[model samples]
Target: METLVFRFEQGQRRIPTAAQLVGVVSSGNLEVLVSRAELQAACEIEVNTAAIGFAPIWQAVMDDFQARWQLADVRIAINDMGATPAVVSLRLDQAIEACLESAP
Candidate 1:
């Protein structure tokens, strides 16, 4: 699938997360928290990182995430430890996939 530009607007119905999935943040790891929620109008993403001047990069990642999934009321909490953009993206995908796989 092609990556589309990310926009902040009301999304589709919230996708239910079957369980909490965590991706470790190490040399080749990224910690991610994916969960379902009853958001008011948009999805919420909280990204905590040690890297400085990386807000734009994270925004780009979130853009891609919003494009890839219908996270209307989903909550994604991420903890990063100097992981590259590619790694961050990978972890996001992994977290979403895990949620879908575990869904009833």
Candidate 2:
């Protein structure tokens, strides 16, 4: 399968996280989880955030995720700590990339 890869972090702070994809957590204010799901299951996105007013923004992020990846049977869980939409998107992409790269 051809996977989309990206450079999550730049400079010396970049750490290879592909090996830690399984149950791996990323970002400080925004924690994201990318894990495998049953083949028959659909892509699941669960977001727990304190900012209730950002529902639309969150929905957009979910939509973007669906469009960007073929996540027919993947589970993505996110815990947001007042992060902006851009940050949320970045973290999600990083998490997915890590998960795919680590797949055996």
Candidate 3:
């Protein structure tokens, strides 16, 4: 297993009050946990993945996610079991949607 962490500083909004978990961690799949945190105007993402030596690819995905969401004071944890990048993006989007739905 490998762990990768990424931080982005362009966040424009803080996450909602409620935390959200989405997807199932299984073969060729992943799970995402999203929540608000004291990130000091940054969005942090931690990925624990079974596929090793893919940091560059994961970094790209993380960069894209940060660009699209611009989340602030948010921490996203992802557990990946050899999932594709597309699946990873999808799960992140789903988690964000579910989390934002609980917004006031």
Please report the candidate that would top TM-score against the real structure. 3
Worst 10 residues of 2 by lDDT: 1-10
Give the per-residue lDDT of model 1 (tens digit) for 1-104: 11122335687756556446667777465698877766765778887777767777878889887888767767777777788899888888888777777777
Q: Each model's TM-score?
A: 0.82, 0.69, 0.94
Q: Which stretches of candidate 3 lie over 4 Å from their true place?
A: none
lDDT of 2 by residue, 7-58 (tens): 1111111222322332223345678766654434366667777666666677
Q: Which pairs in model 1 have colliding backbones?
A: none
Candidate 1 has its poorest 10 consecutive residues by lDDT at: 1-10
Better of 1 and 3 by TM-score: 3
Q: What is the C-alpha local distance difference test score of each model?
A: 0.73, 0.58, 0.89
What is the Cα-based TM-score of model 1?
Answer: 0.82
